[model samples]
Structures are given as structure tokens and as C-alpha cells.
Target: MSSFSIRLYKDSDYEVVRGLFARGNLEHSHMAFRHAISVTRNWLFTLVMFLIPLCVTGSVILSILAVVIALSIIWICSRYVYSYYVDQCLSDDMLNIQKYYLQRDGYGFWVAESGGEVVGAVAAVPSSYSSEDKHTELKRLTVARSHRGKGIAKALCRTVIEFARNRGSDAVVLQTSLPQVDAWKLYEKMGFRKTLIIRESSLRYRIVDFVHFRYQYDLLANKLL
Candidate 1:
């Protein structure tokens, strides 16, 4: 089994953490692209476009154009969604860690290290969307692909939860998209229950947020364990 240690984020760990976040998000985007291609509706649409043009005019160019257009749309939408997450990370968390997390009360940032290398990261921050003072948001949970399956992610998550519990937080909440299926499973295993599903109406987010689930773990209820 691979062993690692989790600790509060240090200034020197910034670059490694940022790279892990970017790499993990890109992996999810690739998975989402494959899932989109496999969807029945998309397959049906492609079939219709290819057949209709061939039946009406017997033109190979139209058939090729149909496939190209379908793929182009998917590619463009996926790139836009990926870029949005990257921008959010740079603008919000990675840019000013001290202001966004360290200096604030009831907020924390952590990283996992193995063999003197940063391999994973997680953060807990005050939730602006929640009305309750005791609620904290878990953000930016990620593990390097090569180091995954060795409990690094679970360790990082527990570190954040313990921090929240120590800070007198009543609950911890997080939002994740469908593409992150493994993360969803991990949160559920860690005693987080689905609180809501948010469907974005904006054109740019619609493709990515077809189903975004919000999960919450009650620190008070599971404190003894």
C-alpha cells in the first residue's frame, strides 16, 4: 500500500497543487467527452443527419459535414466548460490563498505529500451560499492520477472534515458535476448525503451542469465515528 501524509497547505506547495487541480480537471473533461459521445440521443442525431443527406442527394460531402459538425459542437462546448473551471481556479483559489482561505476564520487549505512530493489537495471555506454560520464548503478536492487508489483522496477529505469539526462547523457541503463520478462515490462513502441538484440555465453552463449534485455531511451527526 502507498503511504502519504496530509498537512496544512504551505506557500511552497502552491505550484504542485495548482498543477494537480488542472490535470484532474482535464481528466474529467476527457471522460465527459466520451460519455457525451456514447449518449443515445447524440448517436441518434448523428445517424439521422448522415442518412437524411445520403437519401436526399447521395452526397458524401454532406455526410462527412454532418459528422464534423456534431463533433465540432461537442468539442467546442467541452473546451468552454473546461476553460471556465480553469479560470475559476486561477481567479479564486490558486491566486490568493491567504485571502481566500488562510486568513479567514473557519477556512482551511490542505495538501497531501508522499516521498517529498505534493500529490493531492483539498480545501474548506466559508460557504457564501448558505444561510447557516456553521456550514463550510469543501472545494478543490483532487489527487494526482498516478497516486490515486492509495487512499490519498480519502486522507485529504478526512483532513478537511477534521478541520471543519475542530472549527465548530455543524456541517460540510460540496458541489460536483456528473463527470466526477468517482468523487461523488467517495463523498457518499464519507457520509455525505445529496442535498440538492442544481441545473444551470445559462448557455455555457448548461452543457456541463446537466446535473450538478450538492452533498452535505453533518459533522454533529457523525462526530463520534
Candidate 2:
């Protein structure tokens, strides 16, 4: 904390906070889980709607109306279900950071210039989120879009991992999406390996994106040096 001087996020930094969450890794597991629940709910709703209507209505025109109603029910319920979990968990990184600081389970770093304007940001969350051994999820890593390719992302990543190590984490893990091809590459250079390859989609995202590998190092072993 002394090296970077971290503090809880203030209300005024909402926009920057939003960008941080928006910019973090997007996991396919989340999209896949949400979509599965949504699709299953819709299919079940359709069955109930049509089967129940059969008990009273027998006309062909009525049957067509039932089909339309089923589709509508599915769409509305899917969005509702999606919103519910998002409120419970930060499917986005920035909101997670705010929640982390608010709950005191996570930490954020805002790289600032000597004059005190923020230039980059990163966040780390508990690995219980991943259910692995003393691991931490490194997330919401971003440099301003204009500052791309200046190694700001690398610096932010280093900061977050160091923070995790200090917190006694076994290693750092991240789940990234297709939009961050460069991040995937960077993780590779930093010694992360693909731990899981989920082919199905999960929460919020719909595209066929690949979940990238996780990187790790033993801070305890290094401490002996």
C-alpha cells in the first residue's frame, strides 16, 4: 500500500470505474451459464404455455397466438434472469472493484502521473471466485485507449499480481475473451498456461470466444530470496 498509496474509490470516479470493469476479462463460463439458464427457462415456459392453453383452446388461430406468446415470454424472462445475477455478482470488473473496496475483499490500483491524474488501472479479486487454492483473479486491467502499446498494461498487471502476492495468494488467474487478443498474447509471454478450455458460451457474452490460460508463480518460494 505504501508503494502505490491505494485508497477506497470515491463516488466521483464512477466513469473511470465503469471503464475499468468494462475493460476487464470477459469469461465464457458466465455467458454460457446465463444463456443456458435463459434458454432452459424459455423452453420450460413454452411447454407450460402451450400445454396449458391446449386444455381450453383447440383452434388453429389460437395455437399460432400461443407460439407468439411463448417467444415473448422467453425473451422477457431471459433478460430478467440475466439482470438478477449481474446485480448479485459483478459480471463487469469495475463494479466488482467498487464492490471489492466497499466489501474490503478486493483492491484496485490507479496509476497516476506525478501531477496526480490517473493513467491506468487494475484490480485483483479472491480466488474463491474461482474455487482454486489460494489463488486470485487478476482483472479490469486497462490503459487509456490512447495509451495503447506503451507497456502500461504490463505495469498494471505487475502491480496487481504483486498486490495479490502480498495478500497471500498462491497464484494469479484471469479469464479473457476474444476482444483481448493482445492480452492473451501478453499473458503467454508472462508464463501463464491454459488451464481450462470451455467450448460453450457463458453469461452476458454470445460469441464463440476461447477462454485463455492462467499464469502463476510461488510468491512464498520467491520470498526466500
Candidate 3:
């Protein structure tokens, strides 16, 4: 079994934490690609491309090439969707972790360390959509691939929950994407209930069938303290 300790984030762990988050998010790209191809809309689009070539040239080879090109475009678009999110994150709060998380009250970041190496990370901050900041949003929650499935993620989540509860949050909430199947499961296992789902009409989300899920763990309704 892998052993690790969770603690508040520090300046020195910045690069490792950022890298972990990038890698973890990028790992879902393949899922995004598959989802894109599986969507009926994309399938119809690809089929139309294939049929157009076949009807014009009556050549199986050219038709197959058109199908390949369509699929390749979908693949590239899916990857770009994930890459764009990573870039946005790297340029946003992640660009200044200390300012965004450490310096603020009712906001915190934590990392899990094993053998002097940071293996997991999570954060909690006030939910912007909440009325009067009643909800705390769980953020990050990434574990290195090598150290996953050893209770690291669950531990990180518990840390966030404790932090939110201590800060007088009514509930801890989080947002995750459809590509992250494991993430939604982990949230459910930690007593979080799905509160909302959104289907974004933006190009990136449409390319990956990107559906957003919001989950909430009620600190008052449950005995998580």
C-alpha cells in the first residue's frame, strides 16, 4: 500500500503541483476523442463527408480517405478542447497559487506527500455562484498516476471537506466534466450528491460532448465533521 501525508500547499511545491494537474487533465483526452466520435451529430457529419466523396468519384478508396479525414479532424478538435482548458487554467488561478488560494481567508490548498514527493493536490474556495458564499467549491483534486488508487484522492477530498466545514461552509461543491468518469464516482463515494449538469454550446464543449456536473456535499445534513 502507498503511504502519504496531506498538508497545506507551499511555494516550493508549485511546479510539481502544476505539472500534476496538467498531466491529470490531459489524460482524459482519449476519452474526449472517443466521446466525440460516438456522438450522433459527429457520426452523421462524418458519414456525410464519406458519402459526398463516394457519390462524386464512386471510389471506395477516396470515400475511406474522406472518412479518415473527418475522424482526424474530430480527434484534433477533441485534443484542442482539453489543451485549451489546460492553458486557461495555467494562465488563471493556477498561475498564482499563493495569491489565489493561500493568501485568502476561507480558501486553501493542500498537497499529499510520500517519501518527500508531492503526489496529490486539492483546493477549496468560496463558490462564486453561492448566495452569501454559503458553498465552498472543491478544486484541483489530482493524484499522480503512479500513486493513484491508494486512497490518495479520497484523502485529498476529505481534506477539502474538512477545510470547507471548518470555514462555516454549508456545503462543499465541485464541478467535473463528463470525460472524468472516475472523478464523478469518487465524489459520489465521498457522499457528494449531483446538483446540476450543463451542456455547453461552445465549440470546445460540443466537440468533446463535454457535459459539466456539479456535486455538493452538505456539511450540515451529514456528519462529516
Top-TM-score candidate index: 3
lDDT of 2 at 143: 56
lDDT of residue 205 for candidate 3: 72
lDDT winner, 1 or 3: 3
Best-first order by TM-score: 3, 1, 2
C-alpha local distance difference test of each model = 0.83, 0.55, 0.89
What are the per-residue Cα lDDT tens digits for candidate 3 across 8-122?
9999999999999999999888888988899999999999988998999999899999999989888887788778889999899899999999999888999999999999999
lDDT of 2 at 46: 59
Give the Å error, residue 52, model 3.
1.7
Off-target runs (Cα >4 Å) in candidate 3 are none
Model 1, 49-147: lDDT tens per residue?
Answer: 788888888998998798888777766676667677887887877898756788877889988999999999999988765899988889999999999
TM-score of predicted model 2?
0.54
Pairs with backbone N, CA or C atoms under 3 Å apart (clashes), candidate 3? none
RMSD of each: 1.8, 8.7, 1.4
Where is model 2 more than 4 Å wrong at Cα? 1-10, 20-99, 106-116, 201-225
Better by TM-score, candidate 3 or 2: 3
- True lDDT of residue 74, candidate 3: 88
